[model samples]
Target: MAPSPPPPAASDAQYAQQFLNTVLSQRGPSALPYAEDVKWLIRNHLVALIDAFPSLRPRVALFNHKDGRAAHLLQADGTIPITHAGAVYNLPAVLWLPEPYPRAPPLVFLSPTPDMLIKPHHPLVDCSGLVAGAPYLRSWVFPSSNLLDLARSLSHLFGLDPPLFTRSNPPNPLPAAPSSSMLPAPSPRAPSEVVYSPRPYRFPASPQLAARPPPTEDPAEVFRRNAIAKLVDTAYAEAAALRATREAEANALFAVQAELRGRGEWVDIGVRKIAEEMEALECRLQDVTMATDVIKAWVTENHKGAADADDAEAEGAIQPADVLSRQMLDCTAADLALEDAIYALDKAVQEGSVPFDGYLRSMRALAREQFFQRVLCTKVNSAQQQAHVTRMAARAPSHYAS
Candidate 1:
């Protein structure tokens, strides 16, 4: 039974559902090569084809492969309206969706009717009616590319060149479009547009033609279809170019970010080293400040400037050692002087200015004096520090009581 027509309100929804049912009605791997989701997407693409051009409807048909294996594949039978030299011609076509579709480009064949014969040496379509080398099909990018745009391209190219010619005497029909257009391909190459030459192709005795009767095409619709085809192609081309540009920009940004991150790490290492050096400098500055304070205190306590005659300590003469600190300083000075004398004596011996025996005797006498001086320095420094600490402790209680 013929399926009832959908209501006016639910027409759009029911209309889509009907085509979906037809595409899915067939069962198993024989029907479609895609999974449930892939099949749905395929159906949508077909629906889009039918929606754009109502004449085309997708249906399942058993396709015999040239390699002898047969499977069911979806085929769209329709008249693609082509504007040839200001005249619109409805060209019958059978678009075969390959099993590896979306990933693989589909095949479109010119199905001329019984009254028509394929023109020989046609640039677009060969004797077999296989349409090839259309720019859109040859450079098809999957997912973004679909049957709808392909239809647009086919229509546009067909409009430029007619693929079939009508026969004056209706002798015999041309061979029908192959049982399938999806040929098995071992390479990434698109299906060959010119597979069979006219000489070798044995036209079957039986009528096998793919020609449609003259269509009562609407002028407005024809113009609209042609315009749409041009627009879709233009938009697709622009979109592809835009995607390439955006990808390049993104890659540049990523490279810059990586370089900046490397620079940031280097800067952080420099900052840490600078901080460590600053800490070391602060420690050395504290030691220098303490030594300066000790010199200032010594000058205040005993220094008598030569110009200040009325000063309480009038003589600038060197003071005799009075405390353990003074005694320790003198002892250290003597030790350094003896070391310099020994160094001079060794140089004199090397220069042959002093006899070896004299140099040896002088070095032994200086070494004995330096050892005693260093011992006295060690004892005086220890006693001085102890006495200073005791004086500070004794004065601390008096200050606290006051």
Candidate 2:
């Protein structure tokens, strides 16, 4: 058998050329919507058709129009029927520069009865009689999405389960034809009008009017009264149950208390061990503290020797050891203050009134404060002496000249 030739590519070149001319004619000089939208309309529809019916995957293309618009394809020949929907949908589609673009969804009324492929679910059905004409369609906007995705969503809407992880077997009710009374009287088309008449379907009945009470006497009021009585009985039962629960809890608590008392002897041994460790730590800390004090005294002596060396170097005169001793008094006082703080901290830790870490931190802070205070006082004294010397130098020259 001879192989069939490849399906023809949909051609919208003629329609696109006509559309460009029409746009130029309409605007004369100004730009209407972007020419990109024209291309997008055809492409999006074609993709959407393929997505909705995967069988049409090989048949997607563009078909030319005598006017400016184009028909996106589904057939292997890359062609759309000249007639579709109810009328000769062969009309050129004008792009509406509103919220719903290619996504606002395509209206399917223009084609003949054959073009009514399948009634799609109304994911965003507008019941308002706003866009009524033959070619008027809803504007679909999905800022982050395209028409093919929307078509897929629409296709799935009718067939999918409600997130139940299983295929649903629910029955679909058939759409009933609307009675003439259900439709509004046909209205005349106004000048420059494009959309059609009142909606063919009547508005749904109000919830208040549609809801019918059960056959029983005042079911809601009766149910409400019965519910209250049942609630009272339930509350009483719950209270009795709660009392029984509390008695059981109290019995369990008493048993736990007895068990704890039985283990008191063992707990006493643990407490004694903790106390002995604490006492030993205290003794060790005392010995270290005494050693630290001795080292601090040696540091004071070294500071005095250094001061003497500084004085001898600066003044070219060696001061007596007694004078150097007094110069080192600041260091001595700081050392004594630090030692006292350490002793107090060691005692506090031994007493266990505060944690060992807290005691050490407190002592360190106190020693630091004392050391800074002594250094600050020495700096102030040195500055004052310098100022006095400067004042004397200024007066001495005048006094000597006089």
Candidate 3:
């Protein structure tokens, strides 16, 4: 016998409450006026994060900072690689909660180890080592935005192509200007300051810098370029947002379809519909093939008859017979093409490769083609009959006169 299944885990709310209780017991109550509410929000958000990403649960830590305020630190779960430019970084990060909780977004900072080096090139990242940017922090809205959203946004940013400046070495520094002789000599620097030689800081070079005209002292052109850059960035951000939304919607639709397929009735209904479509397509294909065969046989007989007549007639009369044969052959070819298309569609339906709606569409298109071909054949037959009647009438008048 198979082992019994484990019981369902606690609900998210229940887990959050338990975690909140544990944290309060270990660290003592928050000194803030709305301590319970803040703690509840933090616990709920953290629980949501862990639920979304189970691997993060073991690496996540909550503690009180030196200021006696609560903070959360989440170590990289190993699943998500932190890469910038061409280099992969390993930096655990801290989340500093605001005193007002949901009213303001939390501050995020990279907790780099002794050997880790991180360049500040990301728009959200600052020289002071804080990660505060729009959509996650700066443009955060209460009730709609949460910690998990922030984490997701940050994860997405890390996956993008890192800023160019971060991938390139710092530009060579210009030589120092000649010291003024009038000024007194400066005192020697301390050993600590002298030993630590920081790279000269410069603004990140934009990818389009080469395309842009050389730097001008004109304020108007500078403002224009800045405006253009902002517009481009905004458009890119919107496009990314739209793409993410579409992907999420598509995933949700697939999940729903999978769930529906699990039910016996749904599966039976879908199979029945598919079978009916395949039968219809097969019937239509047979009709088209028969029509094409009839046209081919008629064309072959007409060609033989025309060739015999052409041998007996004058050379000028042979041209008309040949033209008629060519037209008949063209018609036969068209019918055969339509027949082939229907056959392919039938095969696809039988193999279950085509969706029901697609199958229906193919059937409709084939039906239209078949109808048009029938109309053309009928017109050709009517014209031939009229011509035969006209020739007989002309001959009958001549015979009566004789």
Best by TM-score: 1
Model 2 alpha-carbon miss at residue 69, Å: 23
Worst 10 residues of 1 by lDDT: 192-201
Candidate 1, TM-score vs. the true structure? Answer: 0.46
- The lDDT of each candidate is 0.68, 0.41, 0.53
Better of 1 and 2 by TM-score: 1
- Candidate ranking under lDDT, highest first, comes to 1, 3, 2
> Tens-digit lDDT track for model 2 on 46-162?
444444433222211232333535333222111121221111212111122222333444332111121122223322222321112211122233343353453343223222211
Which scores higher on lDDT, 2 or 3? 3
> What TM-score against the true fold does each predicted structure earn?
0.46, 0.19, 0.32
Over 134-229, each residue of candidate 1 has an lDDT whose tens digit, in order, gives: 657766766788999989878877775567766656776454343443432221222322121112222223222234465677889878866865
All-Cα superposition RMSD per candidate: 18.4, 28.8, 34.9
Please estimate how well model 2 matches the true structure, expressed as its whole-model Cα lDDT: 0.41
Off by over 4 Å in 1: 1-13, 21-31, 172-402
